[model samples]
Target: MSELNVELSETERSFGLRQIPAGHARMLVIGRCLPQPIGEVWNALTDPARIGAYFAEPQGDFRRGGDYELPGFSRGTILRCDPPRLLTVSWMPAHGNGGELEIHLADENGATRVELLYASVRKRFAVMDPEVNEWAAGPGWEFFLDNLSAHLDGREVRPTDRDWQSMEGTDRELYEARNTEWVRVREEFEREHSPLPSPE
Candidate 1:
């Protein structure tokens, strides 16, 4: 199978997406900016301690061909890892049933531009859809980035461990609705701010 490729430029001030052919379909390319240097941002992403501080359990060697294991979200081998620049990993669950996540970093005026290239997502993993990941990568990562910046600036950002394994009918419905709205808003946002250029 030919690997998918997503190229994103002008990311510090905008976001971009590209659909590439691989096996059966196209994968989404999501990205954003960070308010810290490349090394700081890279460490925040690759360092298990720092990642756990913001999100859930994070364990990975963060190198080419090394596997990263998180309890639920994803678990797979790293395909590429360039310190303070790029980290591409294959995300799988149940041993071997998933695809890849490619993260790119660029330096812009002392801050780091972080771009997430989520590729080769399988159809079976469609239930926990892109909307859910948006909740995590979009708003969730924004939340984490804010905390990371604060911590880097010598401020305090307390970590939390809250489990909500159970929710009533209305609660679950509301959660799903909100996440749907998030996806919509994110699409609108990208269109407005970084409208895809017309093909020549």
Candidate 2:
């Protein structure tokens, strides 16, 4: 899959959705870069008012040790906060499955590179819906990231970009194909890395 476009090509942009195998569960990491300044991009992510303009309005103190509630989505606790640089949060979706999210930001030339790692995805998600690893979480964040780009550019958020379930055309096809590949790779990684039963 190519880096998503919103009219102009993001020359310095990078995009990825991958699972890193671990002892217990795979880590779901979705990363991308926006063709925007680091400060602006940081504000777009951290400011509640700015976030509400793009993503859901999270209710929380938004400080270290504070917890945020994004109704109908994920409830997150602020584990660490560093201005315009890094933010780590513990994410627990309404379904009760939990994970750790590490948000890292940097200035690359003039664009902002954002990397998010959502760690220790529960086994049940893959077991229940192997078709979409990260399940709704992957595509959902992708949508929000697109909205963040829109918010920075001072344009209306693309309607189709609002929800992952409403994907269409080439994006839908590519997304499904990518998911299939992820499932295959993750299964292979698990099979190879899984420790064998001892003294059975």
List where candidate 1 sits over 4 angstroms from the true fold. 1-25, 94-97, 124-200
All models: lDDT? 0.53, 0.63
Highest lDDT model number: 2
In angstroms, the error of model 2 at 131 is 8.9
Question: Per-residue lDDT for 1-200 in model 1, tens only?
Answer: 21111111222222234342233322344456667788888887788876676665667766677777876556878787888798877766443435566778899999877776554434322122543332333333333445666566667763433212233464344434433444665566456756433222
Q: What is the C-alpha RMSD of each candidate to the true structure, in Å?
A: 10.1, 5.7
Q: What would the per-residue lDDT of candidate 2 be over residues 34-134, giving only the tens digit for each residue? A: 78989988888888888777767789887999989976568878988998899988878756656677778999999988886665445534222534324
TM-scores of all candidate predictions against the true structure: 0.57, 0.72
Off by over 4 Å in 2: 1-25, 124-135, 158-166, 184-188, 195-200
